[model samples]
Target: MNRREWGLTTLAGLTGLALPRATSAQSAGTGRGYRYVHLDVFTDRRLAGNQLLVFVQPAGLDTDAMQALTRESNYSECTFVWPPEQPGTDHRVRIFGRTAEMPFAGHPTIGTAFALAHAGVLKPAMSKTVFGLGVGPTHIDLEWKGRQLAFAWMTQLKPTFGKTVDDAGGLAAAIGLEKDAVIRPAQEVHTGSTFLIVPLATRKAVDAAVLDRAKVDAVLTAAGVQRRGLYVFSTERGQDDATAYSRLLGSGGIEDPATGSAAGPAGSYAVKHGLVPSDRAASIIFLQGVLVRRPSRIHVNVASAGSEIASVKVGGTSVVVGEGSMSV
Candidate 1:
């Protein structure tokens, strides 16, 4: 079948695999084989979260090969795990989206940790495991959720808050929404990577959002907000613990089921902007991808020192959907 028929037009020329499947080339004893696993992150239930593919012990693979594999997987993001180059770190992870590499992302971090534990590379205990990433060392605390499942809490970087868009009407139209759909000024926040956080008035407005890529690109370029994507959110909660509903539209037109990286800064934004009570620690749950049928629940914890934000943590569970070997 052609790339168009396979629903994989993003990397057809680069990867040469449209809706690629795993291909085994090296045997186990070759010492050059790679084991890849697919994971459903931010959800305990199977097949109901952001999909992540992790390539274990990606030895002998160069950047081009890694990017090819990621594009082939067709997941929102994929990771290559390696031994840490930095001292006192357990592992090193290189994150890649369908079209490019990412400094840091939420679900990939949580899912990668879960995959490591599942493969016996890292034991699932009460302690934390730190991975040296492109952004820096990221920490994850793990606990057993069931006989076959685990939950991971990942600590993200301290937010470097950025500018807030004053022209709400222009911002809304840029993303193909009505003027009044934008509830407030859109703010830029970067935990490790940057994203424009747009607040919509209602859940319907959020669900109705359609990105005109040209307009979005033009707006972002003019605003000097250099980042991968935009995160549109509403105060309307669809679940009990959910504080809001969110959707992330990034480069390559990838819509994330749940975005962990954005959640960290978003949680901090809630505290800083007083969207939620800023009196104490806050737990914010973001519901996403319901419109796409792959529902995800992301847990975000934000702590503050009075008016100042202290730290932000993003956590969730993941389930291994499939595992196989890949040939380099």
Candidate 2:
């Protein structure tokens, strides 16, 4: 086991105290109670999408304790919310990577929205929830199935374009991939945070890739990227022809089943590379996670004006899968 896991396990054993079981409980209220909601992001079926752990009405937990709790949960990332303590603010969300706190995460946003729905917080159900985050705020749109919230559409942060890596071959090796699998002129993409995007020749390449964290971290650190990103595309372009079929991976030890942030820039790559015919505009599907048994779907849109591209967008549905209580 990794040191992080071992430490957590050892700590748990030594204290003779197990983590608070991930079960829904009643909120401290006269009537409304707390409930846990599980969302499977970027997939249609349960367990097919990236699993998320959401804790609702976590008003008592402080930031340091929340970070510790995230390590205990050990998912790629965990999200906790303090119910609206003031007007105009929906919820205060705190995000944490297994080892540290993060400013934002896409899957968590979608998953949290659905969790709120499952808990009946969004019963009247407006079109969406504008989750307040550290960086700023993100929106989540809800879909109703006869008063029951079934799906949520999250509008990711406004994307940012960064320097291009342009070395598909070397990057492929950085992630334990073959030269042929690397896509040429791969660029860095981000929305709110930075990620190095190295496209591979096929989805098979991405599926087989195992990121050498040390190498990836070095490159990303030098380039000022918060994380390394890997995107693989299918030759067969589905959806609109302007963007190519693709999947995205991050620097986190755990692979992201789908990366909406990466999708935004990947769509532009398809348009500029001629993989997708975007003489006018760019938009496409980025199918991810089929190789990992977590079938995921992500949509990307690119706006190109003449020879220059104007902007990009990524949209997807997040399914809430599970919830937990943290007492560490």
- Number of the top candidate by lDDT? 1
* lDDT per residue as tens, model 2, 7-29: 99998897997556544553332
Best by TM-score: 1
User: What C-alpha lDDT values do all the predictions have?
Assistant: 0.81, 0.65
Residue 302's lDDT in candidate 2: 68
lDDT score for residue 35 of model 2? 36
Worst 10 residues of 1 by lDDT: 22-31
RMSD from true fold, candidate 2 = 10.2
lDDT of 2: 0.65
Q: Candidate 1 residues 1-328, lDDT tens each?
A: 8867676655555577465554564233344557888899999888899998898878889999899888777777899999998997889999998788888889999999888877878764446888998888988887775434467898888888898777788879987788988877778898887878888888888888888778876776777766446788887756456788888864454567888888877777777777767544456788988877889989888887766777888998898998987665
Q: What is the TM-score of each candidate against the true structure?
A: 0.84, 0.73
lDDT of 1 at 280: 40
